[model samples]
Each structure stands twice: as structure tokens, then as C-alpha cells.
Target: MTNVQGMIETCVQCGECVEVCPFYKATGNPSYGAMAKVGAARSLFAGEGLTEEGLKTLWLCTRCDRCVSTCPVGISVPDIVQSARAELRRRGQWPQKCSNIANAIIEHGSPMAAPPQDRITYLGKDHNVREKAEYLYVPGCWASVRLPEVARASFQLLTKAGLDITTLGEKERCCGLFLIDNGLMDEARELAEKNTLLLESTSAKTVITECPGCYDVYKRVYPALFREPNYEVIYIADILKDIVEHGNIEVKHSGRKVIYKDPCPLARRYDMTKAAREVLGHVAEVVEFEEHGAEAVCCGAPAGVKPLYPEVANELAGKLLKEASSKGVDQVGVGCPFCMHHMSGVQNGTEGPLRIRTPSQLMLESLASER
Candidate 1:
């Protein structure tokens, strides 16, 4: 029922997409390439049935939309892949890893299956939290569970900037990004409704998040899937940009040359290319990746790829880090916590001298020096 065939027909098979597809570049497999995935989507829509390898091909995509950007006919391979994934989900053919993630989100409110009570431990006991505030900070699952330091740094920076921010704490839920990415639309919708109500209950005028997945879902996907959110959704980078430009807090330069990697959802999908750079430029000498902004490469961890195909994900991350090291930067800065998590994981395994830090973390370091 999805116009998969119509979309497939529009493709000229120009292979421009091959140049940008990280999955294909990492694997060197035609099936994992964007064009082949488009054909697979057409087959799935035509009811040709799913094969084991065919399903794997569909799941390999991070849905970064690099192919869509390069398409001569403007055919969106990510759109076709999403349709195919929805079809697979309808047939109960989703990968077990995806199902497990969905279950964890459903039962535990986190993809990592972390306990809800432990969610706020990262914030510590002595902190500024109110029942209602002007801005609600949703750190998403990654920052709250996996990357507590990033969450704390983000909170410290915002509070230092004198913003009236509060968090959902134990009541926070996964933005259902994994479910949405895996085509479990019904589950994603349920979480969207629940989170919308929970966030609206706070009477907050603005919703700020450090997670690109949460920002994208709340700002863009939620409205299309359900209704426009009652509060405005903003990325923390934008807020940090404001704070830095207005001199809300005293910051000293670190004299560290760093490459800032742009998150695909924030940079490509939302055109939010400047905020993170503006913030980073104030504290460190910000360097650009070979392909920066809309053309920047993905960190290769989103949309279930990190859990399902970690080798490929690591490969992509390694490539980025190698390039950064060659550029002679002291560190690689990212706006998205997941990018930091993935790239740092890879950096830890290697002897590379590069360090990974978010703009918030870097600014926090600068602020600490002043004390």
C-alpha cells in the first residue's frame, strides 16, 4: 500500500548514493547499499515475501538519509526503507534485537532496561529541581543511563546560565526512538502520547533535550505522528549557543583544537548546523570535518545499528576518529551524546590520542578552571 513501487520507479540508479551511504561503504555490499535497499523495499511492498538476508539488508540502514540527499531524482531511500521495515513489523519479522529494545522501552522506560528509580542518581541529591519550570530538560535514555557525566554537565551549564530548568527524573521515558526507527509505529505512538501528556503536565513553555533522537522525535516526528507538542522542543546546542553569545557565564578558552561532528538528525534533518559550532568556538578552536554540516558523516550508532551491527558501526566511528587524529586535533567534540558515547568507545579501544567531549562538557571544564 505504500507507494514503494512508485518511488522505486523514480530512481535512476545513478550510484551517487553509494558515495554517501555509510553502511554500504563500511560493508562494501551491494545489498546494504541504498539502491539495493530501494529494490528490496519494492519487493517487500509487492508482497514478494521476506528472506533472511533481505531482512538483514533492511535493518542495516541507520536511516541517516544521506542517500536521499544525493539522489538525482530526489527519491528518498530512507523513506522506502521505513516502509519496508513497517511491512516487516506488520508481518512480525522484526529482528530479535529490535524486539528486545522495544520490550525494554515498554517495560522499563529505557532501551537499556535500566531501573526507573536509578534514573535520577546521576543528578545527585543536592540539585535544583522544581515540580514545574519554564524549561523541561529531557536527557533521553542515553544521557540518563549510559552517559551520566554528559547529563550532569548539560544540567550544570543550563543552571549556570540561569535558566529555570527541571528534569522528568524517574518519570522520564524513552522517546520511543528505537521503536519508531524499527517501524513499531503503534508502540512509538503510545509513548508519544504518554510523554506528551507527562511533559504538558509540567506547564513548561519549552522542552530542551541533549539527545538528537529525542529532539527529532519531539520537534518533528511527534507532530506528524500525533499532534503538535504543547511545548516548544529545542536542542541543548541552541540553548548553549544563546548562553555563550550572551555571556551568561564566564568561560575561558581551553586552547584545544577540536573537530565537531554534526549529528545527522540535527544537522541534516533540522538545519541546525551553527548552534553547536557557535558554542564550541567560544571555548575551543573548533575544526570542521572534511564533510561538515549537511554533508557530515554519521557516527554510525543510531537506528539499532550499534546493537545489531556493532562492527560496522565501529568501523564508521574509527574512520571518523582517524580523520580527526590526522587533522591534529586534541579532541573531537560532538553535540549528540550518542556520538560521544560511540566515538569515545572506539577511541578507548585504540591508542589514539584524541579525546571526545560534548560542548557542554568542554564548557564545564572551562568553567571549572575559573573556580
Candidate 2:
């Protein structure tokens, strides 16, 4: 129902974007490509309904923005995908699974489909630590519920550094990036209001998070929505750097060699890979793997692209594991929890010559050794 003619006009329908899209490359499909899908999505503005074939085409895109980065004309493909999904939802033609996830986020303050009662289990028996803290650690939904180990490491390292950090008891809400990804703009805004109030109650100056999605939303979206002076959002990697720079944490390598898996947010867009390197460099012998930096491999977790395009996701992750494994390293460090989780599964011990670690684990180990 929404018109996308203005946005769609930006795409010149050039075929250059298809060659770089991992989804198109692995599936050999055009529906997910920049030109074809961008063109198809444009028709909806005229009230041309989405057919079964057209739905498959729109769903094929991973929405990773590889095309947007490569496009000479500045057409944003991911925004188009989001608009397409929103239009479908408007027409009552979107996927039920999409709303199911959104429904859980609205009802339970998280997208993990988990009970709200266990949200603060990551506090880890340190009652005095959280109650009298200066930092509030929001591990985000996926990491707090699904990826507990990485969440644990991020906390232990921070706590061990002697910073008083705390989290809400059963009151933390989803940071709402996923909702925005699904084009549920109103819900995303609502979740932000709730989380902003929660942060204000805690009065913590800094929020250390394990998930980049959470960091992106809290730092960028929360301010725009709330439009007030509030707590700062810091990624786990940056926090590690802070601890190291202030002489609060130290890492001993024991001769461990590591290859960095830069989250696309940090490596390409924000250019924070150097800080990530220094954080890990103090602890381990650090090395750069090929396809890192702006060209780094994606964790293939978000965008729901993993579900519909498993083979393509697997291919992208598989290639990274295979390449890193061939490098004869001791460890592969990933900053994003989703990246750490997906890459860890594919490693399977034998798939790589190295083990994958959350960056926080190494920092925690360093803190433990120093003590």
C-alpha cells in the first residue's frame, strides 16, 4: 500500500550489485538481486499485488547491503526489502513467523521467545556486584537467552576489572533493532521508550553490551527517540579497550595466535577494527585473516536470511571457517555474539585448525591471570 516509487527510482537497475551479493551467488537467483528485486518492489507502489512467485523473489534477498556499498548510484537495497516486508504486512500478506517474533518482543520485551523471569541470570550469583555498580550490562535478547556463554565471558571480564556493573532484575526489554529490521517501526519506538525509562532508573553512565544490534539501537536510535541526555552505549570490544588503557585488565597469550572476525558494523562502516585489534593484541598474538576489514564475512544470523537461505548462509560461514582453519592458528576471535555463535557451530573442532572465542573471554582470562 505504501509507495516506493521515489526510492526505487534511485536504482539504475545496473547488474553490478548481483555479482557481490552472497545470496545471489550461492542461490543463483535474480529475485534477491539489486536490479530485479528493486524493480519488482517498485511495481507495488502502483498497487500491483505480490504474487506467490514475487513473494519468493523478495524473500530471497539477505538484505546485507553488499549491493548498496558497491552501487555507484547510492540505491539502498536493504531499505527496499524492509519497505517490501512492511507493505506485505499492510496487505495482510506477510509471513506469520515474522509477526510471531514481533509479538514476543511486544509481550515479553525480548525476541528470543523466552520467559521474562530469567532475564538477569547473567548476573551470575554476584548479588553485591550488580546492586552497587556503575555500569549496567545489557547483553541484548539473543545473547542473554540463546548465547549464554559469550554473555558470561563479557560480564566476568568487566566485573573482574573491578568496575561495578549491574542489570535490571526481570525488566530489560528488547533493544528493538530486529523490529526495525522487520519494518515494525511503531513497535520499535515503543520498546525504545520502555528501555530508556529502565536505563534512567538505573542511572548508569555506561551500558556494556555483547550484541552489536543492541549497541546500534541504544546509541543511535534511543537518543533520537528519547531526545534527552541519557546513559552511553559501549560495545564489549570498546569496553575491553577502556579497561586495558586504564590498567584495569591484562591478557596473557600463553603463545595463543588469533585471527579476527570483524563484525561488519565495526570493521567496515565504523572503522573500529583497530581498537578491537589493540584490545585483543595485549592478550594474544594477533593476525589478520583475508576478507577481513570491509570485506569481512558475515555471521549470517540476522535478516532471517539464514532461515530461507540456509545453504547460502552455510556457504558464506563455511568459507570463513575453512579459510581460517587453514591458517594454523590457535584461536579465532569474534566480537559480535551472533557471529561468535554461528562461527562456533561451524567450527565443530575439526572444521578449523583453531577454536572460536568471544573477545570478552580472552579479556576475562587475562583478568583472571593478572589477579
Candidate 3:
């Protein structure tokens, strides 16, 4: 159990959290505010526990952590809410959507529910994945099953750059960020341990992922849950950026004006805005959305919100897309496959007002042009 007393003391209630929280900003509900969430959890901790209504309210958070950045005292309201969710799950009061995800992962090894044997099919065709290589690429569940293009492009770029990389294929499992967000820490820990062991089994010194959620788990959560990872975990954006800047790979300039939507975890959590933009500059004219970097809005995918409250998720994604539409860019480039999936779903058509593309996809376009 996290120390609610310390979290409660950290909030100054200055309305800074409310200002940036997706639920509060979209619905204008003070009860959905981040500070209010902390207060609610504090009350529950002091008393018996939260009611069903209180549990739902706690799950409303997108877990963007914007409030943590804005709080005068640096209170992590999302973490508090996550802790409350754990308590709710223990009492069987958690959301069914999140519970389903946890169950799916535990039962099926991946949240997408595909058989483990089919995992290698996500690679499209089996390329020679060396067992002992410098890079071990783990395409999180979303990219592996839902959006394989991003994974394929990332793999192609890595291969083209002449770096020796290996993949676990079906051996890879969920990084368990979904479980962690829903307060299923034990389940998350189990997955994390499995992933750590799998990565350690390889001679690769670095682990790469296209999913921001998986990267966050490997970079932040796993270290705390287990021992510090002996291997380095990297976002594909940073990997591609280095490949471009160091002259290992060259891409013909597309000259297309594109707005980049910074995935909340990548932009705010990992401080990866610069690397993403630096890579974008190599292929396209990088245009800024109305909100970029730490101030950027959520696309409605974080903290299991996309599956739990899709209406709310789509509403938030619509707002993000609207900002990009207003800019009149040719395409919207995103680093996170989760963000790209939601954004693509919200777009009007295959060739809508703006195309939603992975950063690696955009780079591949230019790289292909050069070829």
C-alpha cells in the first residue's frame, strides 16, 4: 500500500491539476479533478473504502501525469488514483474492462487474446532474427497484433541501418503496463519478471519498443519492482533519430508539413520530445500542434481509458485531431503505436483530412524514396 498520508500532504489544491487533467478539462467536472481524486482516496483510506461510484471516478483518470508536472508541491495524483484502484480491485469493485484486460493477459500472454503461437506472424514474414544481437526489439501487444506496420517499419529501419538486432517473436509477452495502470501490481510484476528474464537470455544489450507503455514499464516501473535491468530499454524514436543523425541512414526530405502528436508518456514522462522532433526534422517539415511537449493533451489511450471509457477516449482523441486539422498539415506523425491506433481510428477515412502515420513509417517513406 502506498502512503496516502505523504500523497495527501503533497497536494496544495491550487487547481493546477484540474487545468490539465483530460477528464476535468473535457467535462468541466471538478469531482473528476486530480486534486479531488487525491482527496477522495485520502477519505477512503481514512474510512472503510471507496464505493462503486468512487471506484469509477478513480478509473476516469487518463493517467497523463500532467497534474504531477503542474502541482505546486509535485503531488502525483495519478499514482494516488492508481493506488486507490488497487484497493478497489482487491475488494472486487474495479472496472470490468480493466479486469478483462488483466485476465486476458494472464490467460493469453498478450492483451490482444491471440494465441501465443501466432505471435511470430505479427512480424509479417519471419526475417532472420539472430539470437545473439546488439538490439532486442519487443513490439508491445498493440504494435504486434493491432498495428504491425509500425513494427515492420521499425524492424526494417533497424535492419537497414546495419545494426545487429534480434526479436523474441512469440517469446515476447506483455510488458504489463495495462495491469499496472489498473492496480494489478502482482500480475504486472509477474509479466515484468518474465520479460526481464527473456531480455536477459539474449546477448542483446539494449531492448527497443514502439509502444510507449512498454518502454515506460521497462525504463521506470520494472526497475522499482525488480532489480535494475542489466539491459537498456529504448524508444524507437530515439533509436531512429540516432540512426539518422549519425549518417548511418539517410532519408530524402519529403517536404510535407506534418504535425507531431507527442504521446503523453513519451513527451512528458520520458522527456523524449526533442529526440522525436529531431528525427521528424530529417523527413518532414515538423509542425507543432496547438499543444506540444509537457502541455500536450491526451489522445484518450492512457491508463486503459481507451478500452474502459472509449466514448471519453474518442472525445479526447477528437480534440487532439481537431488541433492537427486546424493546422492543415498533410499528416500527423506519432511515436507511440497506442496513440497512432487511437488517432487513426478517430480519423475520417484512409485518406482523410490528415493521415495518421508512425514516425518510423514517415521515415520509411523518405528512406524508400532514397532507395
Candidate 4:
């Protein structure tokens, strides 16, 4: 369990973060939000016990870091949630997906449990992929297995830009952030070692990935866990930002005024908001939302909250849709596939014009500027 003593002291039960909480606003349940969770964690350290509801509360958060960014004292909700999750996991209250995912990652190299040979299915072999490339594309299991099309435009653009990029085929495994997030530190470490070994064998100087979860894990978590590292794993946002800033890639998208949905981990956790906008700036009439940047609300992805509480997740999307639609932006550009998957689809009860799109898709119709 995480030591709540420090964070508890930091959080004076200030209700400042209540407005920023997606869950709290959705469920009308304070305990599900940051301040309430902080109080519950503090109580536990003060000899109060965790109940079923309290444990479930920790699981309901998407770990989007909105609360922490909004908190005046910098109390980390994810760190606290992780601590509680680890404690719950120790006590065997972990969701079935935890063991299921961990086992899959351990054996199959990623949580998808598909054979490692299938990773190549995300992108086809038709392209002239090189052995010594500038960037290595490591799409996580979700992107590789379920959402291959999201990164297709990126691959097309990269090829057009003459990047000698290569993929790991079946060799690329999980970056292991999921395991680490749920407290499987040792397993995450092992996966990191495997990934680092594979990356070391490649001539790629930097890594570009479409998944923010994988991006965060590869760039941040692995180095912290493994203690040894090589190769700079970068988010596609950063890479694209460079390509645009350096005049390597040209963009000329100008159909609809769009808003970028900053996935929590992608925006706040990885600090890629400005760079992402800068890359897409040339192509898109990117409208800035009031709650953007680190303060950007979760589209109810990540942290596995959608599965735990569907209504709350829906309400979150509803609320966010209203917020974005109020600003008169029709299209919402998402960087993470998970965000796109959750936010873009038509919710059964909602009626709004908030269409979801991945940046790669947005860039597809936009003509590349003269290189």
C-alpha cells in the first residue's frame, strides 16, 4: 500500500479539486473524486479501515492526473490511487483482468495474449521498411491488435517523409506500464528488460508510438523501473512536432474547426500538449478548449474506469461533449486510440455533434506541405 501519510498531510481536505473530477461530477459521489479519495486514504492511515466501496473508489479513477494538476498543493491522485490499488491487490481484491492481463503479458509479451508473431498485423509488410531506421514504431497490443488503422496515416506520412522506419514485427512486447500501474513491479521490470534488450539490438535512435499509455511507459516508467536504459522512446506527437517545426513534413488541413482531446496520461503525465498542437497546427484549425492542457478532463479512458462504472463513464463523456460542443467545435481530435474508442462512438443516450477522430486520420485528408 502507498504511504498516505505524506499526501494526507498535503491535502487539507480542500474541495478545490471537486470541479476537475470527472467521476465526482458524473456519479455525484464525492468519494470517487480526488479530495474524497484523499480523505479516505488519510482515514486509513489514521486507523480507519478500507471498505468495499472505498477500494472500489480507487479503481474507479482513470488516473488522468486532472486532480493532481488542479490541486494547489500537488497531491497526486494517481500515486495515491496506485498505492490503494497495490494494497487492494495484495489483499486479493484485484479485478480478474489484473491476473488475466499480467499472465498474458508474462507469457505472450503483451496483454493481448496473441502470439508475438502477430504484432506485424498492425502495419502490413508492403512498405519498404529498413533495417537501420530513424524511428522504431512500437504500437502496443491494443493498437497493433485492435486498432491498426489508427496509425495507418502515420505510417503513410512517415513513408512519404522518407523515414527509414522499421517495426519489431513480433519482437516488440509490452512496455509494461499496465503491470506497473497495478503494482506488478517485478513483472514490469522484467518486461522492461526484454523491451530494452530488443530496442538495443535496433539501430533506431528514437522510438515513436501511437499509444499514449505505451508512450508514457516506454519513456518514463521503464527507465525508473529498470535502472538502465538506452534509446529515447518518443510519442508520435513529439516526432510529428519536430517534423513540422523542422519543415520536414507539411500539413494543410482546413476543413473543420477541431478540438484536440488531450488524454490525461498524454497531456499531463507526459507533457506533450503544446507539441501535439504544434504538429497538428499546420493542418488543423485546432480550437483550444477551456479545460485543455493539463487541466483537460478525461474522456473516461484509462485507469479501467469505464468497465468498473459504465454510467459514470458515459456521464463523463456527456459532460465533456457538452463542454466542447458549447464552444461550437464539431470534431474532437484524439491522440490515444483508447480516447478515440471511448469518446468518438455514439453513446446510446447522448445526442451531440462531438465526433471523435485520431490525429493520424485528421492528417490523412490534409495535404502535406511542400517539403
Which structure among the candidates has the greatest TM-score? 1
Q: Regarding lDDT, does 1 or 2 come out ahead?
A: 1
lDDT of 4 at 150: 73
Tens digit of per-residue lDDT, candidate 2, span 266-285? 65556667777888888888
Which candidate leads in lDDT? Answer: 1
Ranking according to lDDT, highest score first: 1, 3, 4, 2
C-alpha TM-scores of all predictions: 0.96, 0.89, 0.94, 0.89
Alpha carbon lDDT of each predicted model: 0.85, 0.72, 0.81, 0.73
Encode model 4's per-residue lDDT on 1-371: one tens digit a residue.
43556777878777988767878777787778778777666655565777777766777777777787678887887787777676667767678866787788888777668887566665776654456676788777767766677767777667667787887776778777667767677777878777877876777887888889888887788778775556787787777777766777667757668888786787777577877677667676788777788788788756666666666787787777777788788887777877776765534356675667777666666764322
**What's the lDDT for candidate 3?**
0.81
Preferred candidate (TM-score higher): 3 or 4 = 3
Alpha-carbon runs more than 4 Å astray in model 2: 1-4, 28-30, 49-53, 126-133, 348-353, 367-371
lDDT of 1 by residue, 1-371 (tens): 34666788787777888768888778888777888787777678777976766777788888887777788787888878877887887788777888888899998888889988667867988864578999999888888888889999989888888988899888898999888877778888888889999999888999999899899999888888889977999899899888888889878898889899998988889888998898889889989889889988888888888988899999999999999988989889888888888999998899998888888899999889878
Assess the local accuracy of residue 265 in candidate 3 as a C-alpha lDDT between 0 and 100. 85
- In the predicted model 2, the residue pairs found to clash are none
- List, residue by residue over 1-371, the lDDT tens digit for candidate 3: 54656977666777877767888766777777777788778777776656655655687887887778888776788788888878777777766777788888888877777776665665666475567788898888888888878888888889899988889887778888878887788887877788888888897799988888888889899988877887999999999989998999888889888898888887787677888788888888999977789888888677777887777778788887777878878789887888888888978543467888888899999977886
Clashes of each: 0, 0, 0, 1
